[model samples]
Target chain A: MGPITENHLPRGLKLLLILAACRGPEPQIPIDPTRSLTLQTDWKFTSPFSGLFYDYYRNENLIFSGDLRTNLILRVFNHAGDSQYDIPLKAVLDTLEDINSCALFAPDSLFVMEVHSPRYAIVDKQGRVCRVSSLAHALCPEPGNRYEVSGYSNGIASNGRSLFMSAAWWGDCDNTGWDPSISRFQYIQRYHLEGARKCRIAKIKLDPDGSKVHFGGCNILPHLTDVPRFSYSGMERVLLNGKLFLFSPVAPYILQLDTGTLNVVHRIPIDFLNGPAAFFPPPITEENLQNGGDLVSKPSIAGLAYDTSSGYYVVAVLHEVPIDTPEGENHLDRPWSLIVLDQTFTKVAEHIIPGKLYRPNHLLSTTAGVYVHRNIPGRAGVVGPKTFHRIILP
Target chain B: MMRKVIIWSVFAVSCVPGSQDARLSRYLQEQIGLTERQFPKAIVVVSEDGCPHCDRAFADLVRPRTSLRDCLFLIRIDGTTVDLHGFMVETQNVRFDDDRSFKKLAS
Candidate 1:
């Protein structure tokens, strides 16, 4: 064939090149045929804590079930569906207070953070506590009196032997009570698998006017609200392209932070396909409250998973309006939905699970399948012990 | 036996037409200050077997919210706490632990 000229090129090819130049480089997402496999069983148990979400970590021999309540990591066989194993998580000295977030260094070594206690623990698979570090230790270089630790570690992610943790420091340093200003100074710390702090990244201080602080290397920018109402949760590291994809539930935004400088490389705004304001629950009127109905807004993006095959991010989002119910009164009525997004985090397709499936607490992808834990009544807290449904998505 | 009869009597009285629903509405209103208009279109009342308070709470306190009849009425028997799963299934005419489906009871 003769050399093609610009004049002979199709109209679409020219348009694509012009757009690509402006947008710069993006991750390539592959398209694959869809398939799903469901595991049967609705294991139920009441949680000592309030939330019913848990993390599922598996190795060749065992699958460890960790909850946000107790430090106990229930161990079961990899193939044991709906059956409890004989071995329980080994006990450590420092209680795994807030089992909300956990990172496994290997099959045996793990890091657990207590979001409420603001404490960190490195424990072996046998459950022996290797090291316990408190936020007070970092804040006070010289301590005349030891500060009480809160053990509330919201997010935990690992990079080989080193673990990264997000800490929320609440209460006044002196009184140790809830102080709005005190919470603004949240920190992201890197530690050895044994729980020793290597380096810490402090949150950018907000201006007096409450404007965002623009620090160069911080993943959470200064402009972001640090008030208790706006703190993030469930920070996990996605090791792809030598970059860490951090998922924060507070600003409820996903941030891509550079591991070296600890600076945010990109911020992907996450919201329901319908605008954020549009999905928010209607204001709670006296009528709704009295009727025991709560006007609850669906979360824009709650649980996120990376699909390696498609190079797309699959997020578990609240697709329906949460039923209006009294606070503390559980409403097991809403349907959970999942949305698949391309590299830019723009939604690709929305998948609403067909029936009432209670509340979904966590979403994780494994070689075996895509596991999602549903919050069943009497189930363990946010990191509930029960494995409600295992959806082997194709 | 006598205590059981008394408990059974209370349960029976609580289930009398609209008594359960009325008492529940009143209790919610009094404690949480919920008005009849503010009641949910559906409410799942969870209880265990042999607990007189839970029975009374459901029958007398929860059943009266007919104003919110649009709201669903579900009785979730605690299989962990009681053996009422079979009894609940038969009486409520629903499946036992069908987490896949939520059937609305016919008025």
Candidate 2:
């Protein structure tokens, strides 16, 4: 047979090649939210991080749930979704007042931070309080920074000697009223385990000057008042490979910082298909406040998790849906996209998840798969035995 | 006798809407500084426990209509003590149910 050159190829084959060359990159596979591996637990699953969105740590095959005050049962599950152990945390629950953030500082101990005060405790796996201390006197005041340790602790993690937490900061830190003129900022501060402020690592401005419309309080303001979904301002923290990485839903980059130097070493850019969505909520005017309606909702990066086994990163992109669609009205019911990136941060696969079946928030990634909250159609936050659906990535 | 009393109490609470509504109205009026003349035709209850987006949408829907402003009383159930100073400045009849009396009535 003669060499099959371009001219020698059939007409139909030539046309097919031309069409294939003109076509864009391959489309993402549409993932059916219902078609997933389910994790049935004996106890009802309540989010451990009270009001804040959180991700739990996965050590080897075991996944440890957060130890915040809102946790009903401190659960430890294997990669196979079977419960290894569950602690009620009754012994230490009473002692830790309004626990907001929890981190495993030691192999068998949990470092917990409070919501109402600058107090923290070290509790063991057996729910026994090892030590308690308050940070009110320890934190040295910054000249311009009105650092409020209580309530503003967004992302908290411990590296044995120090604890790091992000604070959603605005004017005065009281969060009494909304001022559009002043720019909002997110301050990540490092502190000694004993509650003393070590250094301010990073301070990134949250919103463009006067961009947001309303500020109800510190809690409501960070998440945006009247906009019910998770805010782009909320920072997600991960302690990987002896380095701390901070990622905000809104920011396009994951900040890798060295705890010892307190310097942001690397700014790893998240290469999404078409960058992160541009979020702009409708201006909450005085007239709207007085009289009542113009609010615009936007899509956001719901959650981010790193897989220990595969050295891959899985991010949940909460895509915006039409307001008229009944199922898409709530933030939890919105359509989602699962983006899988390799160790080099290259996009490996993308899955388009339809709304109303699953919530991509509070993602727990492991060797087996990424675990997401399986929601019943119509009803929101219904308690049941089976907690999450495991989505095994490609 | 105790069981009978419990059943009767449950019946009184569940079945008696006329007295309960009136008491609730009076209680709400007093709590929110509502006048007898300014009776609300619609009452929008926004709870922190409910979907935040839906609550915000409801607030947005009712805000633009001047007719709804006079007839509607927007009651918000906050998790913590809400500073009503900002709420009072608005022309809309917005009230924070701090005492959780509304939650009690619903329960």
Candidate 3:
């Protein structure tokens, strides 16, 4: 072949270059570091959990909590504090065998929860199961007898018209071993507010033969060039100018897709507010180890919430540090941090949550108060109930 | 003769597998007890849905590869499954209680 001309370049490569060049530098926005409030509850729960907080009537009077374990959403409150209601999700959970993940589709007045039995159910304000859809049934007919509906929906968002959610296909990941080369087939999907299947969406599959692909285990590098292979995780959707902005926590990247054309128009890099590996504790030196310190780090983004008030997305990251002890076990404490990014998906602000906070799975903004559910370890037991903080966002 | 030699060289290069991918596969098998032969038939079973660790596990299993063809029959499984025979091959090291059972037979 003679010298390749511009025509030789693939359409994707050309478009990528054009978008990269045309897109102006991301605008910087200031973040109010003190713009946060926390409401602690006397309750606590065991690990391996999911939760949601919502208000039914938009009365801004009653707030509710749904715990995955009790399989019941109950009305809860403190006599001295503001009035809060816990609406039992049993009506919805009863329709499904088990719940995997849940979200409050605020715009639609519906609570969408995913079941490991391979179904999504939409519950109404009265806690009645309004609609139900099987994820496996919609995705594949012969989805195969070997296929197990992996319970790992990382992110859930809505466009007022429909609910968009993403899940990492884990069945293939677990049995196939932990090779980075073979990872990437994890699937993501979108659903209607009524729990109807919309689309399975696309997945980036890594080469199994492992020629061009290289796996880095669990950690993700900010630079794409650093790894030959990686996958998307924890996706969040925001409607910007009639288009959909998709954000993934794993890659810390955002994609602007035109709804009309269904084409990706732009890819933006998101900068976490905390420094690289900021979630993890420092390595144990001889001095530190002697003093009862060990190497500990929790450097993953567990939650993503779009804050419409500030025109930015707030990310909940779990930061952990190992306690200095003889066993050198990791004392993973959740220091909730918010990384704010503007419409362009640029990092604007970063704030670390103070006090003893556990992993936060959901962040909700309501007229009543900002509700957040903390992911507590299962050992905490079913009694005492898990903590759900209703903070009045500043 | 030169033309023939050049053609043969090109064919040989095409047949040779990339070392990088092989190294990666080896690394994965060693670290996670996952291997190429097993990946094609293996199914991933996650502890919880929407859990980040499960996400990481899936991401690592499906990352892109250069030398390997997509021959693996990968599947996603939930942790609640009482029986995993269809997806997981019974291994000697894996043990289950009366609540579950796994018999290791020659694959």
lDDT of 3 by residue, A1-394 (tens): 6998769999999999899999987533222223432333322321122223223344332223335432355333331124344456767656776665454545234434455454566666567776665544333322321222232443333333344444333433224354454422221111111111112222211122321111111122234222222233334444433455554434345566655443567765544544442222223233443332222343455555554345555556555544432121233344556666667666766766642443444555443233455444332322334344543222
lDDT tens string, model 2, B6-102? 3443454446488677776776577666777776655544444544344434444443443455444444522211112223223446655534565
Q: In candidate 1, how many Å is residue A380 off?
A: 13
Q: Interface RMSD for every prediction, one decimal?
A: 9.4, 11.9, 10.4
Better of 1 and 2 by lDDT: 2
Flag regions of model 2 displaced more than 4 Å: A1-61, A66-72, A149-155, A158-163, A170-233, A240-243, A268-275, A278-296, A322-328, A377-382, A387-394, B1-107
User: Number of the top candidate by DockQ?
Assistant: 1
The B-chain TM-score of model 2 reads 0.52
List each candidate's DockQ score.
0.07, 0.03, 0.02
The digit string of per-residue lDDT tens for model 1 on A191-271 reads 111111111232222122331211122325333322212222223344443455655333445677776556778877666
Task: Report the CAPRI category for model 2.
Answer: incorrect
Question: How many clashing pairs per prediction, in order?
Answer: 54, 5, 52
TM for every model, in the order presented, reads: 0.49, 0.54, 0.43
Q: Residues A1-394, candidate 2: write the lDDT tens digits.
A: 8787999889999999999999997644433355454444422233433211123343444445543222344665556556556655666558865556565544466656666565677677777877777654433244333443422323444444455565433223234354555433211111111111122232211121311111111221232333323232335565554566666544455666666554667666654456553343333343444221312244666666776667777777767556454323547567777888787877898777767666676565555556676765311232234456666666
Off by over 4 Å in 1: A1-63, A67-73, A76-87, A93-102, A113-115, A118-120, A130-135, A139-155, A171-243, A247-252, A277-296, A320-333, A358-360, A374-394, B1-107
- Regions more than 4 Å wrong, model 3: A1-64, A74-87, A104-114, A122-137, A141-155, A169-249, A254-266, A272-298, A306-312, A316-337, A342-344, A351-355, A358-362, A366-394, B1-107
